[model samples]
Target: MRRLLVLGAGTAGTMVVNRLRPRLPRDEWEITIVDQSEVHHYQPGYLFVPFGTYEPEEIVKPRRRLIKDGVRQLTGVIEEVVTDAHLVRLADGTELPYDQLVIATGTHPNPDETPGLAEPEAKQRGVHSFYTLEDAVALRDAMERFDGGRLVVNLIDLPIKCPVAPLEFAFLAEAWLRERGLRERTEVTYVTPLDGAFTKPLAARELGGMFDERGIALQPDFMLERVDLDEQQLVSYDEREVPFDLLVTVPLNMGAAYVARSGLGDELNHVKVDKHTFLADGHDDIFAIGDAANLPTSKAGSVAHFAVDVFVDNVLRHVEGLPMQERFDGHANCFIESGDGKAMLLDFNYETEPLLGSFPLPEIGPLKLLGESEANHLGKLAFRWIYWHLLLPGRPLPLATSMSMVGKRRPPAPSGNGSSTSPRDLQEVSL
Candidate 1:
């Protein structure tokens, strides 16, 4: 029997196995998945935890239970990959050989990479983040005690999972403060390394205007050097300081270390793979999907879901000695929580920047793009149910895998003196 080994039982790996198990002949194939933890988390829900929108238990489930019964599930730490011998080495010294391998270990926040973040005294000093379950729960308690003061939200680096999450947190926090009648005393500021509110000019301008209207200050182009615990300030590379009573930061994110040790990953420990096809640069039998691969797209679950649709077909064709016909276009869509029971949706691909339009249909969307609505907020909340029931199970969604321009249109041309530049004038930048 041919053995197929998968690393990490997260969203991408779990979906890949569930979708392929029924299609591949069980008598001829032995599929197995390995992960260090038995618990699977709804990562997006982490954004809601601190705001009391979700409890910790609401978004977690047993990893073993989620996998198909026909597929073997192994819980153990991966030490390294013996790529030449086609086997992965576990920390406990067990060796699992495979005819084919898929790495979906994903990326993680490494606070230690930045000075004063991972220090034992950081939490006590009011440094916190909602990136993990434990951290989110702790931040919830902190939010309860915060009456009024400087509440600063900052992003340390780019390419973090769910690039819009920090902005969402800012909007949610501002609304939460207002609801508690603490908005008058609280000074809310967002600090980022980028020159604008977001990477895309149109989105950034829209979001920046919202920040201004909401009384939240934007400190742009601030390259954070370190957290000054004693002074309770964020020190930048250019020697500017932003003092805060409470600091919520998104730490630097990097891929799993095993990929680096195995000599298959790039500088950030992400596996080097072809952008169109997930095949690793030097190996035919190996593939990397999700955040583990160096794809020029946002590291969001939507990207993972869409990429899996393309990857399954490509992998099957590749195993049969056929060229992969499916090419992923880095399709990604995200709901930006804009506070006050409303949110905005963004849809784009490798070739197109987010444009104003309806989604899933031209000018007929129940959902709107680059515009706020209560329906969009409901859609974002309703996705949690869909993720657990349909997405992870590899069932097809009504949405298409590739991005469509059917409903999308560029903004109206700027007309004042012909001096103002349009959003189209700004070059598109990718992850």
Candidate 2:
């Protein structure tokens, strides 16, 4: 039997297994997925946990239960992938040889990469994060105790799981404070290393306006040096200091270290994959998906879902020694939650940044793109159910695999302010 091994059982790996199980004949192929944890998390729900919108139980489920029949699920730590030998070494000294390998081991928050972040001193002084289930639960309690003062949402580094998550937290925190009569007393500030509110200028400008309207301050270009927990401040590398009453931080997001140990990664340790094909460089039988691949697009669940569709077809063709025709364009869409029961939708791809318009259907969308609407907010809220019921099951959604131009509008010429020069290097972080 041909061995098909998948690393990491997160969004990408699980979907890949589900999509491929039905196609590969049982007599010829044996599929296996490995993950360190049995519990699968709906990471998007982390944004709402602190605001009292979702309980911890709502976003979690057993990984083993999610896998379809005929696919094997392994639980253990991944130590290294010896590609030359076509072997994967688990922490327990077990070696599994694979005919085909899929690296879906996604990126993770590394707070220890930063100075004073994981230290006991920082924990005592109110520096917290909501990246994991435990972190989110801790932050929920902190948010409840936090009555007023400078509530700073900070990003230690970018390429985070959901790029807009920090922004979403700020908006939801603002709304939460307002509902409890603490908005006037609390000052919400967003600190990021980026130059603007977001990577896409059009969306950035619109989001920036929303931030201003909600009275949240945007402190850009903040290179986090260390959290002065004792001082209740975030000190930048350049010596700039931003004081905070409570710090909710997004730590440096790095790809799985095992990928680097196997010499299959870039500077960020993500697998060096063909941007259009997700095929791991120099390996015909290997591929990387989701945040594991160094795709020049958003590191989002949406990207994994859309890219997996094309990848599924390509995988079949590849096993048959047929050249792959289906190519994955860097398509990503995200819903930006704004305070006051409103949200904004952003849709874009490799050649196009998110433009202000309607989505799915041109001019007829109940959900406006790059513009705020209540329907967009509801759409965001409704995604939690769909993520588990449809997306994880590998069911098809009607959205275009590549970005559609039907409803989008080209930006009018820059108003002497050089708006057209917006940075395209920024990766959208969607969930």
Candidate 3:
């Protein structure tokens, strides 16, 4: 029997094995998945943990229980992938041979990469993050005791998992403070390396306006030098400092260290793969998916869910020496929680930026894109159930794998008089 080995029993890895197990002949193929942790986390739910919207037990599940029958689940740390030998070594000295390999080991936040952020006393001094379960629980405790002060939400660098999460946190924090009558005393600030509120131009403008409306200060283009623990400030490379009482930070995210050790990763330790195909550079039998692959898109769970749909067919064709017909367009969609029982949705691909329109339908969507609505918030909340029941089980979703522009429209251009034109007077073009 041919061996199909998959690393990391995360979102992408779990979906891959579950989707392909029945397709690949059980007698001719043996599938195995390995992960270091025994529990599978609904990572997107982490954003809600600090806000008391979701409990810790609600999002955690046994890793073995999530996988389908007839697949081997191993809990062990990955040591190295001997590409030339077609085998992977575990930290305990176990070697597993594979006819084909899939690397789905997702990226992780490395607070130590930022000086003074990972110190033991940093948490004691109110430096917190919500990226992991432990951190989220800790942040919840901090938020409860926080009376009022300078609350800072900072993103150290880009290409982090769920790029929109920091913005969500800031918005939620602002609304949370308002509900508790602490908004009057707390001075909220958002700091990032980007020149605007977001990477996309139009979305940045929309979100920047939201920041202004909510009275949150935006500190853009600030490259962090280090965290000044003594002064309780974020010191920039240009000598600018922003003092804070409570700091919620998204640290520098990087891929697994074993990828770099195996010489199969980029500068960030993410595996270098073809943008459309996900085939590892210079290795026909190897492929990397999810945040593990260096794809030019948001590293969200939706991207992984969509990519797996395209990847499953490609894997089948590749093993049979056939050309891969389906090409992934770097499709990604995210729900941006904008606070106060409302949220915004963004859907785009490699060639297109986010546009204002209705989603999954033209002019008749229950969900709106680039605009805030209660439905979007409900959609975001309802996803946790879908994630555990439908997505992890490799069941088909209503959405398509490739992005659709049937309902999207570009915004009106600025007027020649150097003033913005009214939306009602401008003619919008379909994207």
Candidate 4:
């Protein structure tokens, strides 16, 4: 049987095996997935852990349990990818040859990359991170003991998984403190390197307003230099410092080292792949998906799900010696929790920003885009179920893989006065 080897049984890899197993003839092709560990994490659930909404057990599952019946699963730490030899080397010196390869090893928190943000720093100061299950649980314990202080939610840098999570954490912490009658006593600040609350101006303005309304200060353009244990402050390279009594931070995010060693990665070690096709540069037989790929889009599970849909089709076409017909548009949808049983949905692709509108069905949607509502909150809560049951299984979702502008109201061109009269742009549309 022709070998179809996969590296990393994470979000993208597992779904690949599941979606393509039945499609690829078992007699002609054999599928195998490899990972360094047996444990699989429901990563998005990590966000709610600090608030005690989810437990570690609820978000953890065995990787093997998620794999399809026909696919073989192996546990091995990836050492390197020998593209010239068409083989993958493991830590134990075993080399697995592959006719076709898929790299799905996602990004991870690299605290060591930042000076004074490593183990010693965390141990000395009250530094905490909620990126991992253990980190989330630890942060929960830290938060439980935190009665009133400068609660800082800091993002060390950008291109992190679930980019909105820092904002979510700040919001949740505010609500949590308010619920405990400590809101007035505590000061919450969101420190981000980005210019505003988010990368996009429209969303940033909206979110920044929310922060102001909640009494949370936004410290934008604060590039972190180091964590100052003595002063209990986050010091930026420019000498600006944000002090904190309780520090919650997201350190530098980096891709797997194997990608770098294999010469398939950029400076950050994320695999260099075509943004649209996800095929590795100079290698048609190799592909990178999910956070492992150096795409211009957000490194999110939603993006992976959408991209996997297109990727599955493309992989089949390639295997059959046919041209890939589909192109991924970097479509992403983020459900932003605004606290107090309210959430907002933002849907956009590479070209368009999230517009305020009714989604899926115009004016009749159960979900609203770029606006806060109870219905959107319910949708966000319901997604956890869909993630486990549908998304991971590679089953069809009601949402379109490519972003649709059907329900959204675009901003009309400049109107009135000497302005080039046209419809208002989506940026001008109020939430």
Candidate 5:
């Protein structure tokens, strides 16, 4: 019997197992998934935890419960991946050999990467990040007691999970403070290394507008150098300083340590993968998806869902000795909460920037893009249910694996002077 080994039981890994569970012949193939923990976290929900919108228990589930009935589940710390020999070593001194390997071990917050960022005093007194369940819970407690002061949301580095989350926190906090009648006393500031609110130009423009609307200060192009917990200040490399009563930071994100120990990952410990195929660049039998794969896209849940669609087909082709298809196009779609119980949706891929229009359909879209609407907010809320039922179960949705350019309106080409024609001049393009 052939052996297929999947590492990590996070969103990406679990979905891969479920997608392949029924496809592989049970009589001739053995599928096993390995992870250090037995719990699966709905990471997206972490964004809502600090705002008291979601409880910790609501976002966590036993990893074993999500695995397919026939698949084997192993829980232990991974020592290393012996890629040449196609074997995985557990810290407990057990080694499992595999005919094919899938690396879905996701990322973790690396606060220690920044000097003095992880000091015990900093953690206890002022510094807190919402990238983890514990961090989110602690942040909730901190925000609850905060009467009036500077609340700074810092993005320590780029490529963090869910790029929009920091902005979401800022928007939500603004609303939270208003509810407590403390909006006038609490000052909200968003600090980032990027020049704008988001990486994409169009979305950044809209997000910047939202920041203005919510009265949230934007500190752009500020690279974090160190944290002076004693002074309650964040100092950037450029010598700019932002003081805060409470610091909610989004620390650096790095892939699983085992990937680094095995020499199978890049400087960030993210596995080098083909953006279109999710396959390891120079390795034939190994594949990577989700946050672990170093793809040039947002490290978000929806991206993983799209990647899995392309990966499953390639995996099946590999088993049958057929040529693999390069169908993935860096597709990623996300809903941005703009506060006031309204949200906006943005859909784009490698070559296309997010455009203003409707999504899933052209003019008949149930959700609008780049425009705040109550329906988008409902879509965001409904996703929690979709994630638990439709998404994780490996069920197919009407959306395509690759991003569809249909129903989008791109901005007009720049007219030499750095300005473009009217929005109407930009025709809607379809994929």
Candidate 6:
């Protein structure tokens, strides 16, 4: 029997195993999944944890519960991937050989990349991050004690997981403080390296306005050079300083160290894969999906979900010696929580930027695009159920793998005076 080894049991890897389990002939193929941790985290829930909106118990589950019965589960630290030999070395010195390999190892925080950012004083003195479960729990404690002060949410660098999460945190914190009757005393600031609220033009415009409406200060283009725990401030490379009583930072995220040890990844340790097929370039019988794969798209759960849909079909085709029919189009969609029981949804692909309209269905969508509504917030809350049931189980979603542009409204043609027709068109445009 041929062996199919899947690395990491996160969102992408879990979906891959579940999607392929019933398709591959059990008599001829053996599937094995590897990860260092046995617990599965609902990463999206991390954003809500600090605000007491989601409990720790609600976001975690056993990895084994999500895996199929026949699939083998191996929990250990991966030392390296010997691509040429089709083998993987574990920290315990055991080696597993495979006929096909899938690398879904996700990214994690690299606080050490920034000097003094991970120091003990920073952790003890109200400096917190909500990327991990531990960070969320610590942040909750910090928030509970904070009566009123400068609460700064800073992004250390780009390419972090769930890029919109920091903004969401700022919005949620605003609402949280208001509920506590501390909005008048608390000063909330969102510090980002990007010139605006988001990478997308339309989103930046809409979200930027939301920040203004919620009385959240926007400090754009602040590239963090280092954190001054002594002064309780974040220093930018440009010499600009933002002081804070509570610091919530999104530190730099990097891929697993094994990818670097194997000489199989980029400087970031993210595997280089074909953007369309997710097949690892220059290596046969190897594929990568999720944040581990270096695709020019948002490193979010939705992107991983869409990639697995294409990857599963391609894997099935490869085993049958047939041409792979599916192709990943850099599809990504996200729901931006705008606080006050409202949220906004966005849908786009590699070739097209996010447009304004509706999602799931172009004209008749229950969710609006580039617009905030209570329904969108409901959709975000309902996703936890879908994640545990449909997403992890690799069931087909109602949405397409590739982003659909049917229901979106395109920017109006530029009129006279070097200005566009719509206010949203004036924002930054990226494809």
Give the top-scoring candidate (lDDT): 3
lDDT of 1 by residue, 162-194 (tens): 999999999999999999999999999999999
Please, what is the TM-score per model?
0.95, 0.95, 0.96, 0.94, 0.94, 0.94
With candidate 2 superimposed using the best TM-score fit, by how many Å does residue 168's alpha carbon deviate from the native? 0.7
Residue 33, model 3: Cα distance from true site in angstroms: 0.1
- The residue ranges of model 5 lying beyond 4 angstroms of the native Cα positions read 361-365, 412-431
Model 5 Cα shift for residue 203 (angstroms): 1.1
RMSD of each: 3.0, 4.0, 4.4, 4.2, 4.7, 3.2
* Model 1, backbone clash pairs (residues 3+ apart or across chains), number: 0
Reference-based lDDT, residue 54, model 6 = 91
Better of 1 and 5 by lDDT: 1
By descending TM-score, how would the candidates be arranged? 3, 1, 2, 6, 5, 4
Alpha-carbon lDDT, every model: 0.91, 0.89, 0.94, 0.88, 0.87, 0.89
Off by over 4 Å in 6: 361-365, 411-431
Q: Mind giving the per-residue lDDT tens digits that candidate 4 earns over 1-431? A: 89999999888998999999999999999999999989989999998998899888988888877888999999999999999999999999999999989999999999988877785657447899999888899888988888898999999987898898898888888988999999999999999998789997667767988999999999888999998888888999999989998999997889999999999999888999989999999998999999999999899999999999999999999988899999999999989998998989889889988777868834446587777889887887888888888888888788889998877875454355423222453235321
lDDT ranking from best candidate downward: 3, 1, 6, 2, 4, 5
Q: Count the backbone clashes (under 3 Å) in each candidate.
A: 0, 0, 0, 7, 2, 0
**Residues 35-94 of candidate 6: C-alpha lDDT, one tens digit per residue:** 999899999999999888899999999999998888999999999998778899999998
Task: Encode model 5's per-residue lDDT on 1-431: one tens digit a residue.
Answer: 99999999988999999999899989989999999898988988898898888999999998888888999999998999998888999999999999889999888899999977788787666799899999999999888888988989889887888888888888878888898899999899999999889888888887888889889999988999999887889899989999988899999999988898988899999999888888798888899899999999989999999999888988999877899975788888888887779888989888898889878744436578888998998888888888888899898766778887677887666566443234543453210
The regions of model 2 sitting more than 4 angstroms off are: 361-366, 414-431
